[model samples]
Target: MGFDSFAMVDWSSGNDTGPRPRKDAIWACVVRQGKADEGPTYFRNRELAEQWLLDLITTEIEAERRLCLGFDFPFGYPKGFARALTGSDDPLGLWEWFEHRIEDSPKANNRFDLAGEINCRFGGKGPFWFNGLKRKINGLPKTKADYHSPFPERRSVELAPEAKGSFSCWQMGGAGAVGGQMMTGLPVLTRLRRTFAGKVAVWPFEVLDTPVAFVEIWPSLTLGAAPEGRIKDAWQVEQVALSLAGMPIQDLARHLNVSAAEEGWILGVSQRKPNIAPPPLRNDCFALPAGVNWTPVDEALGLLRERLTVVTAAESLPVMQVSGRILADDVFAKRSNPPQPNTAVDGYGFAGAAPEGAQVMPLCDGRAAAGIPFDGVVPGGHALRVLTGAALPAGVDTVILEEDVTVQDNHIAFHGPLKQGANTRRAGEDVAEGDLVLTAGRRLTPADLALLSATGVADVPVRKTLRVAVLSTGDELIEPGGTANPGQIYDANRPMLIALMDRMGFQPVDLGRVPDDRETLRDRLNSAAKQADVIVTSGGASAGDEDHVSALLREAGAMQEWRIALKPGRPLALGMWEGVPVFGLPGNPVAAMVCTLIFARPALGLMAGEGWQEPQGFDLPAAFEKRKKPGRREYLRARVRNGRAEVFASEGSGRISGLSWAEGLVEIEDGARHIKPGDLVRFIPYSSFGL
Candidate 1:
């Protein structure tokens, strides 16, 4: 069945441009069943427009009519962008990702900075370009001439013959840069998806099994010339909405059935073949291959690295403010370190290459101190009094330390046979001008800041801090300090995971806890997608009846159950929640902590632009012995004392005390063997995992 109502929104990403109806502002129109077309409504900002739309949707829902909503901006970027930006090829995931990163208000927004940030992820070249900001944005170029897109310039839908004149979503400004409209518009869509939840479906991506469907539209496709008195944006939206609403049910259904899941398809662009149903949406990038059961730890790690890419964008910050940030592009010295030749110490400066015996030279008229140059050059046989960090005067190639020379009257006496340029700092001695000071993907430290500052780099381009949301699920869980009823236990995983993320330098967003209800978990996850780059949940990861997290993900067609060949933490669920990556760990505290450290740590690091982090381990003599089984790797909570590794007394997954007791973990490889007291074992300290 087709929609009974149609709404078209001509969106804008700009500020509240004032009360008068004008161009470059939001214009929306709706045509409802059994009613004349309503509203070519004008809104100054997205907030008002969104509220009005929401109210309209509520009214339509009450009337038991389905709505087809359309927005002007592209719903997705060109193919491959979603995969590159969010580790998934699903455009809706990109929508959720943008929902979290883009900050929009009436008067101001961070679209330019956000666009540049995305460009920075592509090494600061660009798939996005053209800055409209008064000041410079780090990776975003000011003109199309400087752009070098790593992905295609346009989506396939935009290239369709009927859509020939449509603007590329990559162009950010200077005439028809729909990219700004998209950056601001997608978040609203994401919010609408959340607000509507189960009742709404995004066309071309999900099957239209809901009461409402949202699709991308180009008003120009159906609108001819506007009436002379009407604002073009308003006229077009009204006309388009009415046209779509008036179409035959069969024709509308055909339009709705066409698919382009990765790069969203625009309605009315191409004709669909009769009786051929559109293919189902492509499998999410996180979905595992069929028939794969238990995966090895190494294979899991490899899969994570292969599938995940940086989700956070980059921003330009002052060098002093960039410490602990990952560098987005290779930084070059603006000018050389020691910029020009200068004195290394308070001394008498003169030309070198004099006689090998003791010599006396007449002094120049003035002294050269730091930031103050001597007025005149030093003559061949003359010296000038110079202080430390003073630029060398012309005709002077060396300096004799004040303590090494005897100054009397207008002359200084010192021994010759001195090396040329001795006691004089050379230009570019530390870092030459235009030399690469820091490479891309490097995490800046305080020392790195000093080096950058010394090399005349005032600003640094760095990846934005990755924000990870921690969630815990289980009906039996309660917050700490809460009075627990029968069967309920305190939730330990949320705090532990949040702390772990913080310790690893990611911004952790506490999503608190949700009980074992699928709907509640779904709502929480939808909300999390708007606030975090990744989600780490400690429970409901298995396929058990109460495992709502994994079950909900599977229902959404994005879940992969990886029964890893490891003790304590075997059921690891990897999935996507509204496009945001979700890592599902075991319910037991010990197993949850182990899976997170062994898997999520390195994966999150890569997504944060820090690249993969392999925990360093050292072989140590075993202080405890046990028989090991083949086909499964194992990690035991252990502490080193007197050069030997000692494991916890119990290897139980429920022992939360062991996490606190151990200083490190002793790893056992997948093989059957008897580990004697003197056997060598690989010990990885907690510090190595950034504890």
Candidate 2:
């Protein structure tokens, strides 16, 4: 169903929390009872305002009416802010970063102090000015003259191409300055994401079509053009709501298609055109902070290898038992494969090089069976019968095959002369003494064991197996094979990752599901860390995550790294928890699988002491066509049909079956996104990855 009700939150600028009603706390306007011309109901504080909003949403749901929620603050800053603070370009990256940095409650918060600290990180005393406190806050400017900002005064969204006259987010406690509101506003967004995760669709970040969708809006855009005599705030809300209600569905769709991932879009910015589909991401927005560069697939693979320290601890195992395990040390041949020269083929062994053509040699008295070599030295001009693996007797330097000579009356006749080394296997022919055989960090295969056995290496050293713990977080998830309620799905990521790790030879410890509760998830993850060398979690890793596993990692002083330039798995989170490395994958089943294989798999290998082993991919022709943007790398789930790469029909990452349907992934390079039929793309087989 389309949106049936509209709501807006006019956030307050007050910094104090008191039991008494706040004069400028938070005000909410809702189009209740399907009446778009209705005025707003004032809320005195954030606590009451949010509760009332939730109640309105619940009421709408009961009546089976979809709702559209709008808030006045910017959803995010311009691009570089995310890269500087969180090493990622995802807008939610900023949200989670802010979540950890800000401390807030219903009564009072450190919004001004937090702004000052943020300004310092970007170059102190200027980016954030306007200290709204009774006393001076260190580093925060008391007057406009003291402002010294390291960055530009306004963001890209506040300048040309977007909306003009939008104030800087760095302004705190000043007229028209949204800095304080944003500091508090983001936390509210996070809480809402957590509270109404499954039901609410956050536009531009998540695809719309859920029961309710929330977008960032500017009241000034509409209120500035309000009719005369409608200058009141409540009256403005009523008129804006009525104007929005009059818009056709198709018109809203055009506005929904906006180019504002980091900085959100205005709700009614496309009424005239009403079908303003977003253009391809322009190049100007790609400019990120210095030292923060896009990581290509090969470079990412190299980085992973650089981080994986070769396993130092080694254990000795019998050469036969070491198969399927990685070597921890280099192995040398104890002795050559052949201690003495032997015949490489069934032939006659002569004592010395034969004369030029038609030489006659007396046949040996005893044939040289493989195990029973002739004991007596051959007489001059004589030959001995030899087999493929039979040892050559003393003074035997060449072999004449039976097919090349005729034996009659205990003598052999030859038409052609024999060379000294013809048909003769020299000593150490396969391997020389003390030669390097198998190197450390090489996984033991059947062939490796055979080589070790042939060289007489009795034992080999290998590293211990790495322990990996897995968990899936979300309230809308249930264990696979269990009955699911409406809007619930099975926990595919946990099991999928567990299997992926197993294929790579790591010991996967299943820690199971964690509900959308912060404390419970933290406890469970901490416990998993103790039992595992590496921990993996799927879901609750996104910026919009209600139970934000990424935020918890930040809270625990974890060193989280992410914002990789990869498609389908951009939301991946990597960090260390309680000394154990953790990989937090996106909740989408396909994204979880892709991130695990492309990113987590290598990191896990490093923790296990395995040096870089990149999954092999080969170039193949594309059977379908696709157009993608530049900068980010893309991997399309594809299968080989008619010897050509065919991607899955649907591009949605949530489709788990696509992973199963795919035989491999077709990798498009960082900048090359356009694909035509017969175009060569890198295809990485699932088998090559041991999947």
Candidate 3:
């Protein structure tokens, strides 16, 4: 059961210590519902402490709040001790026995005397030991040297690895001893349980359905060192109470499911390391400042660019398989293209300056061809037969194209104006070794692969493909392939979003359609968060009765709705669900597609490690005239015709056919404008957005 508040008490078994707030005195802290943390109130005696606790419980119960009250002492004895002392195995029976025999007051208490009486009943040697009094009792010893245990030294919970530093509950009257405190504290708890009969229940021993549930706590289990100038006991109870109150309801419920009824368990005993899911990278990256409303188009875009970051991890893949993947690291050329100088064309090689006019030279002994270099060098004023792609041999400075020369008797003749070093390729001319070829965040293309392959790059480091889950929410919606009733329409958003994501090289997880029920939408979102890097839901995004998508995000404290100043689309919901970013779009098909293209597309590209993608636009003559408002920017579904841009016949956002009829969008800036034919306007094609 979840608790509305928490109260932790550090118990003391000593006499009336004066009111200076010293150590070893009772300190109780209460963290009330929706209120600031209450003080670690000091109590000099058990009577005063019990009265203060009962008053707090009364206040909480009157307010209708459930309280998880914890006390720093053992609530139950070791397994067999309770059965032997009470005849039954119930631990509360032992509480009753202690309640009837124990005597207490402000001046002193009978904790040590009771321990001696219990020891005398069990053969007079003992499970309980130690005495801080000047005179020793008959059965209780003053030290461990004379003590003998009839029961186990520790409970099962004390042996757990997380509870390693806890002391044995049998050690009474010494430093770190809990036996004295347990003997004194359990009786007061029994009275509280009896006085408030049905209102209070002990955890792990009874169902925690009452308004107040009592549990055992060991402050040392979670406490660090106390701060300077603060009393250690006060610090411990305050910090422990705050920690318990801050835990998630679900996590706090897990701590109450232990099975140590006969030998009570300490809260948070075996749960030092919880099994909750790890949050995603930069989980709060999409958070917006509170009170932000009516954001402009430019401001919204800027916020998206500033807040989003790459969420995908990188890995190395073969160059051939890296196409369409974003580069995670910059790539350098391992070897230069045209690694060594070679002939650019099939020609004759020579070693001489270009002749002023027609000139002829004797042929050399060897000929140069592709992949077959000439073994012999040509003499001055001599030429050798060479082919395309042949490396330059010694004494070769120029090549004469075979088509431009005449070959007679193995001698080539070429005309003047044939510049020196003409037609000969230079080493590292295309790319130099160790040159920065491709930068990180670039989407690898087929042409880029060719460049990398030529530069000796066999493997490329690229980011893993981002998975985007697409969902459509509305009770009035059904899948397109299924038959639709009169009140239901075929779901169009999911298929459109999936196709858009696939075209952008993202893996689209089809989450199908969800109804308007909040719980059903919540379940779908949770399932989507596990498998997708991002989620896109196209309906229930606004602040309407059926808008469960936005409502659920708000419930998680992660929703941000932006009333953007843009036509065709306005309300855009941005939030995180279980660490995965979610984009909530309008239910109308036209607005959904428009918002996805304008906002979600660039944001998703940034998250996919592709950096930010801005759609390219061109200015063209307007083919129609219209007057636009000044407060919001407008995008009209348009197609370019004969050097002019013509928008769709109607401007209504619900006209789904207009989206299919247009090839692009004509953007009008956020200002009043009287547009007419021949006026130039910016036009962005669907291809520019990778449609």
Candidate 4:
């Protein structure tokens, strides 16, 4: 269905504690709300804006025309935050709480005092920070340096995997901060909702397609909305309004079922539209060690060889039981194939070559059947009965049989022409003795097992299965089944990595979690070194105060800083613990998996006695376009759609769900500045990485 009007409010804080018809207030644009061209009005203060919005919405409702209104501030805070603030879990209650307490007027307001009052209710010095005025309030600090919030700095919506350059709501006075706008704006929403009652609907918090709907809009998500000019915010509101108006009604219907209610969603971003425009390309996208030579795909394999040594310890197992095991040494044929020349067909055998124009031959007294061959040679001009795979008698040069000759009472008459050596076996024709069938470093497959059995080989020397121990680091992580505190979240990386290792044919040993304590973390690594060939860990690899993995390795063993030139996998740390290789992956789930596949997978292959292999890449047209900076390679979680690689909308490493949503990875080459739609991009299917 078509909306009768598209409306948006470009909001402003206006004044700290007062409301007047300020020069820079709110720009309300209501495009053609019912009866044609009735809105696109401006408001000087939030009170007038709310009154205008409510009146316009009321007019549109009476006309029975649906209106879609977009707001420029957050609809809700982080999950559980609103629930903590209000007795009820509903975010509407938070709005009501704000509305009941805030006092708004034309020339003066109590926004700062109101903020301080709200903070005082929530443990005295928190939840709201930053003051525009020099006057000090009891709870609200006067400066950013003095501000200390008891509440989280960011909301759950602000922490979305790909939602970048977001402002913290707790910071109320800064230019980019949305805290003041939320404080003043939420009251307007509450008043509008109350005045309009059943006529107004809020997105994510309410079902879509209502009479009048409100949605949170971010102008930045719409690329190209602003013209390149010296003047900023000139046509942003108009262009964004048009963009939302032009979007298909069917696409708008998708917002009816957003998953999380406590933390609202921004318009135009969805799970289905993975090929949406990417964030502005910056030089920081290329993350790697500065001024250091980095290797490309092929050269990286060689460098990996130079850095890592293959495991030498070998074990012998039956060929049938070594399906995925790599061979330690060459496998030779135990016996020659065919052993001796056997009869190719069932026919007669004779000692002499074929005679010209001879159609009849006598039946011979000797008969050669498989495993019951006649010892004597057949007489000339006589035929000997032979079966397939039967050994030939001495002086028997040819074999002719059943189909070509007619036989009665042991006497056979040749009906067709006889040929020499047509149905007889020759010794050792297929395989010579001691032929090397399979070489070292070859992983045994089912077909390889069959080939070995056919050659009379029972067992083979193969590299032992790599024992990979997985450990999850960080104190904030708790196991999935266990209870967690307010700030704690269940460990996602460890489960994902453990399952990945299992599917990749490695014996994964669950080494469990290591707390933030340095001594405990070191002790866990020491324990892993005793039982594991490779210790794979997530978190505690970065140079943060809580990270102890790198320091432990540097003091106890060895550490090599590759700092790979790749996106989503750049923060990889490689080290050794008591001669055992350890891979310190990024804490972010998405980044850890990418690093595991491209870096750790190949290294493990080398340890398993296989050659280093670069996961193959496929070239396809890119479905999305972006301005990029050239330095390191980038991999996007993407899917194949209509022959194009559609990347996931988020570039956030924290979005773990994208991994399951993507079918493959789109690889961008180093030194490429931009990617345009229809540009051939190298794609690596998740299957290629054995993920």
Candidate 5:
């Protein structure tokens, strides 16, 4: 018989409000291997919940596996919340509180008036010595009655301090601290844990103190696209339950229907010359396909840490550091903007000295600003008038302000002597002969272009724009430009998906809509792969008959991974067609966009030389109520206000309006079936994904 390694309990606090039970209060226990048909059970009280949890452990789990029972509540509470509420600096205030409240008698050494005394007393060594009797009682349950000790047991109920030993009380803060305020799920979980020891193990989310582990799953079918019995898919709950039963990694991957190597093949065709005879089919056109693994989103990304490289080399690009993105490379300056020395202000440039009290006459050398400059310099006490940013003439050393010099004759006299090199602009100060402005791999901006133009540069060396091909699938879909027939829907995916590619720095080639035709798909894919670096087609990536994109992928090229175990975009396909990466996205607009943000975006980042391109997630309070199915993760459309996040009420993957109303997305993984309002949930802004 196998050890009953899985323990489950439906947990919840009786005082829960805010329109939903706490997520930690409900538990789904797996007694043995194989998928559990039932979902999580709800509990109204801790006593009833703990009673049922203990029974499950005793009956279903074998003695050896009994210790692996996982409660759906928090095991270790945070130490901070108690300090914040009780105004006690000591870390053990809550723990001491437990000791005082649960003790056999209220007068049992009323030193600190600890809270969980009855709970911590069991952790002590000796039988909470009744009078002078010396006995041992370590494993007794918190609810156990008076000691069962035999010989010479006294009637006095006072607990000896020595019996307590070094058992220093500590507060179980964490989520329980939040629960302390609302008395939601934390206390119920605590009561359950204290009721049973050594029969359960609590595993928590990476940073959470609660024992619930969030698992995200992907699938091959949409929520309601296909009938119930027809859906063939695996969920995250199945993985977690099976893995906890001690399934090996390789076996688990295989059980999840993932392949470790490439076992298929693909072909490509070259362009033909016009008026030339058709060439015979060649053997070189066919080759063995590349092997790619279909894995969970987390697992798939975890493997690329050591195997990926970023490319950023291009020709004729300007100096990338100073100019930002290089508009063009190896390009030369057209001509100097200011062909001569230029003045920086409106003043007079004169040579030599002026006569005493000799009023200088104002003579126009010329009007010079940025584009125009004075041709000749002032010679022999002659003055050349200059303006701000105007080129100063040759041989003029001093410039006097027009207001300071009183003009009476053909010459000008300064009320005060002019300072040399004052207010004069020099030629070549902005740029000298042949200078590097921008370099390759630099993204060009308006400011960069201005600097280059100022330096006498034009027509820069920019890398040829990366050509990207975008296409949409699904027989039920109709082009937005055309009239919609009965039972057909207009296509918002093409435009929305194309806009995503555009913002990501791609020159998009809209391939229009592709019906569920294999031959047409094969031809279009072959052509697009040759012309574009990436081919993005939304819809029809599933295994259904109407979902023909995967089949067309095999006909056009080799596919690496198909159907990642993720929600929203589970039926995603990653393949190489004619040397270009082709992404077969889910047909639903939301799924297509999400898949692009998650899988396609990262893959594009890899192609475009970015080290990483993942969205930044922040933990915020939930503003609205939301419920989720266990075992599958979801990106709930949500809006954040005043540091709190509230998911949209109509957060269905097929709903487009929800996406529009959401300011960001809340990512809820497995183990978290429902999020209560005000709970801190992780969210990513729409702008972060370049939306």
Candidate 6:
């Protein structure tokens, strides 16, 4: 016995049709499935529309969902449905009262469409959502015009529960509402600001641009009582009611508020998408550029196991046993920090009662300095002034500073106030027994060392510095000061390597440069392996006759891997020499630096007990205006400029200047060989490798 509902879409009605077009009308039964709207019920005329809506609702039963009828027409007639409900002879007076209540609504001066409003209300009421044309009141516009557009042109005066003042809920049609910048032909965005506020929203079709997009507004209805303004068609209204059926009535109102805001009716919104996690990296030996995406530098670090190998003092020296080493353990107080109370100011020590305001002078007694205890007691009413940091005399609870009292006739003046226990440092004031003194992982700064010394802790446990022996091989390499003979290169790698190791907190033993002789190389490698925790040799891992470092390391232990599919340092080698990790880098300066950063830097930090380290990479638009075929991954030596990172002009792999001028390396993957200007790219820092 609920209200029967029907939907009428008058696609042809417009300004050209008549003074007011019955654009679309719907008469429906608002039940579990929606209004059983059959055919056109309200488009014939306003009086007929009201009568049809009244008939639909009057025939309703006491159902869960409301029984209502929505007509695709305006209800602001000469005698509105409210006047009829009031049973008053003064219909205009009733309208005047209603107008006063809804005085905030915008003026509606133009003809409206119904179907379009139904579409927009459901389109996800973003800022561009439109309800309906502003209907002028008394030929005067409302001072504070509502920025939020009106609802559909549908009339619900009769369908509303019109017993008293304002209907708690009402059903109306929204069609031909204007939305977006152009306010063109788009369905109305039926917006419900508050379900019980008595203000219903309707949009004309002329406001929106997408019909199908309008249905998105149903979930946003929070305040209004009816769904007819948003979804007018029989099936669509049924679907909307079903979607919102199970939700709490209050929750429905909240959702409407959110939708109204989304439709751009409200101010302050966020439409930007959130950051997405990068796709996973490939596990293949040669990672394909498009196989998967690399994770963020920080997140990617989780996959990296620490390269640290903790060797004990029997094998490796503890940091505490060595000077200038970082503290590995926290040192704490066992007894009171001060141990016992002492004088805070310099003066004298005497035991005996020195009454308040009493002043008695004693002849110069033997001085009691710091670390020296006093056993003598002063005579009654005698005072003892003590120096700062001096031990307090027994039976003496007070020490008066010299400035507080005067000495006359061998008796101190007693005008000033005498603090009974002034200037005294009680035992355990600074620190109590067994308190935490220092924590582990301290870097042992100068102040830290002082604290340790103060706490009587000289020897402490610390992470042992990894001993690194740097070696450079190649007959063409000469010492820095040595005159370069023909085909001889000044040893740039040695100096660079030494500096790199120093920054990494390594005990670098400069083994100097050695010729690429098989016997000499083998002996030097053995000597370094026996003494150093890590051994690095340059110019011998590549495929060449003089590249004998790998062979020598193989003689000592197994060679893990000879090369990776990387440019500039394809022949880099990872191997063990006498059980010591050995890195064999390319002879070229740039290649050596790159290899060190990518492979060796993390290893050294691990050995030092440092936290896990990972390379930081930033994406920049490529500055170079060129293209190349995509295939192998390339690390271009580049410099950042004006927010864009550009490859170095001297990009030759063998050019030493490239490493010096380059801020970082650009990683190219996924068959992305050719790069265009302004393309985003990843730049890896040179210092990331401890370079």
The lowest-lDDT stretch of 10 consecutive residues in candidate 6 is: 180-189
Q: Tens-digit lDDT track for model 5 on 487-532? A: 7899888998888878876668999887788768777876786667
Q: Which scores higher on TM-score, 1 or 4? A: 1
Off by over 4 Å in 6: 1-305, 312-321, 326-336, 347-367, 377-382, 396-405, 409-422, 429-449, 458-465, 499-505, 514-523, 540-575, 585-691
Alpha-carbon deviation at 533 in model 3, angstroms: 0.8
lDDT of 6: 0.49
| lDDT score of residue 264 within candidate 3 | 89
User: TM-score winner among the candidates?
Assistant: 3
Q: What are the per-residue Cα lDDT tens digits for candidate 4 across 453-527?
A: 767789899888878999999889998988889989899999999998877667799999988888898788878
lDDT of 2 at 404: 85
Tens-place lDDT per residue, model 6, 1-691, is 1212222222212223233423233222233332223322233333343344334433432232242222222223222333343455342233344333321111221222322332245342311223334652222212213223233222232232221122111212133321110111111211111211222223221122211111122211211122223423333333333223322233333323332211122111112235598756766443434433323222212212322253413222322444445456556765676777787787544443355655566544544567666557555455555667877766566666666667766556644355566667788788777777766544355666655556666566777677889999999999888889899989899899888888766778899888989889878877887788888888888556777886654333233244355555656766555446678888888878776776677766665655445678888898985454343345779878899988887657778888778888987763545567888888887766555
lDDT of 1 at 672: 87
Give candidate 4's error at residue 613 in angstroms: 3.1
Q: What total of clashing residue pairs does each candidate reach? A: 1, 3, 0, 10, 64, 108
- Candidates in order have lDDT scores of 0.83, 0.73, 0.84, 0.73, 0.51, 0.49
- Taking the tens digit of each residue's C-alpha lDDT, what string does model 3 give over 1-691? 8788889899988889997889989998887642326468899999999999899899999999899999999888887998788898899999999889888888877888888888998877788889778988878888877678889989988988657888888878878779888878899999998889999999789999999999988877655446446898897786567556645454467678777769989887653555588554555322233432356788778767765679899999999899999999999999998888888998888865686798888898778887788897778888888889999888897898888899899777778777788989888999999999999999999999999999999999999999999999999998787888899999988888899999988999999988899989989988998899999999888778988887676544343544677788855677767557789998988989999999999999999998999999999999999998676789999999999999999999889999999999999998999899999999999988888
- What 10-residue stretch in candidate 3 is worst by lDDT? 284-293
Query: What's the best-to-worst order under lDDT?
Result: 3, 1, 2, 4, 5, 6
Task: Report the alpha-carbon TM-score of model 5 versus the true structure.
Answer: 0.45
The lDDT of model 3 is 0.84
What is the per-residue lDDT of model 2 for residues 274-331, given as tens digits with 9 covering 90 to 100?
5477655647433444445555556555544543344335799898787767788889
Q: Which stretches of candidate 4 lie over 4 Å from their true place?
A: 1-301, 343-430, 617-628, 638-650, 673-680
**Of 1 and 4, which scores higher on lDDT?**
1
